[model samples]
Target: MEQHNRFWRIALLSLPLGVFGLFVIWPLFSSFYYSFTDWNGFDANYSYVGFDNFAKIATDRLFLQAAVNTTIWMIAAIVLPTALGLMLALLLDSRVAGARVFKSIFYLPICLSAVIVGQIWTWIYQPDWGLLNTVITQVTGEKFKYAWLAKPDTALWSVIVAWSWQQTGLSMVIYLAGLTAIPGDLLEVCEIEGASPWQRFRRVVLPLLAPSTVVVVALSVINSLKGFDILYIMTGGGPFNSSDTLAMHMYNESFKKYLMGYGSAISVVLFLIALAIIGLYFRQLRKVDRIYG
Candidate 1:
């Protein structure tokens, strides 16, 4: 009877497992297979061209530029939000007057849809009558017309600023949770030892917040790598492809161009990049454990 019950339990669990495999695993493996072919995402006329798509991606100058832009976005996204979030977290955690309200205000942006944020910022970045340029002109007493999202020079950075504004709230909440988890005893001990606020943060708070830092950095990196919706809605990977990232380029190739095989190849490359980043994160975690254990 026990063995029969166990068999029934296993059978019941297999339903959801099977559904997941069919939807997720099957599509992943199929895409890998498709990457080796020259499938136009329709019709039956297709031939396997092993590694040709990957070779093209390797040789494509536009893809290289997209890769470079993605790297820049990743760096800026991780560093700027994290530093600002840490500062904000510490400030809000002090329990000042109306700090709760302030925290809510900052976190409100995180709940806004990326498409909405992109559209709003796109309007703000307009060269002639945009709010940003208007303010600059008013303050500086000169004409400050500049094509923020249209010019190759300022396009990428313009997107970065928008991305940062949307992402900082998430980092702030993560750091705020980390700050709350710190032991009160430890903080008191630091104070008793004549540690200044900066010294206490450097020596005590930061070391204890390492785990939160890891989480925030990893999430920031992954989100930055997968940056698509905002870029897609705002620039559509252009004003001459200056704002293209790997994700946007992949979407353009796969869906717009209907080159499913090439899109699959781009997906595979992106998967490897994500895997490498996750692997590096774990390796660093291990190193940290060894040093601090």
Candidate 2:
């Protein structure tokens, strides 16, 4: 009977394992192999020119700029949304009236498609008749107009804000779940001990939210690195490549410029960076888990 059960279990897993190997693993290896070649991404004839593409990356000004921008995006994306989400989660976790309505309103942005969010924000940032500028002008009685998505200095940050708005809901939901996991009795005990709200949160609540923090941090980092759709639609990496990310750079090289080999190299670099961050995060999570346990 054990043998029969094992056989069925293996059989049940085989199809998914095979599919993953074929669709995911194989393509990943193929991209790595092609990164060494000078394929234009379409033609059948190509030659291996290894490390040449990678060498060019070192001197490529646009790539360098994209790398910096990506770093900024990664940082902003993780910090702002996570902070705002935690705050919102705490607010909604209370017995405040209309908490459910506020939650639904906050979460609505996350449910909208990225393209839609980009378009909506694009309208809001319009210099001549945008929602924001118009509101400012009306309230202040002074002509206030600035192209938020056009200037190099403001473009990247503007997009980051829009992306954060969409992402904050996800963080809030994750934190809400984490808050639910905390025992209510523990909070009551803290109250009974005359601990201030801040002390209760810092001493008891924060320590217990480690698992949720891990999830939120990991997801925020991954999503930030993968940012593309909003950037593509809103900025298109415009105003002298100011808002371009590593992923956008890869796409332009591979698809737009047809420098498949170079693009593959960029993708490899991105993958490695993401892998390193994930490794460090997992290590940190282990430490947190041990301390909290």
Index of the highest-TM-score prediction: 2
Minimal lDDT window, size 10, model 1: 284-293
- Tens digits of per-residue lDDT, candidate 2, 141-235, equal 99999999999999999999999999999999999999998989999988998999999989988888888888888888899899999999999
Which TM-score value belongs to model 1?
0.94
Q: What lDDT score is found at residue 5 in candidate 2?
A: 98
- The model with the greatest lDDT is 2
RMSD of each: 1.9, 1.6
Model 2: which residue pairs collide? none
Clashing pairs counted in every model: 0, 0
Off by over 4 Å in 2: 1-6
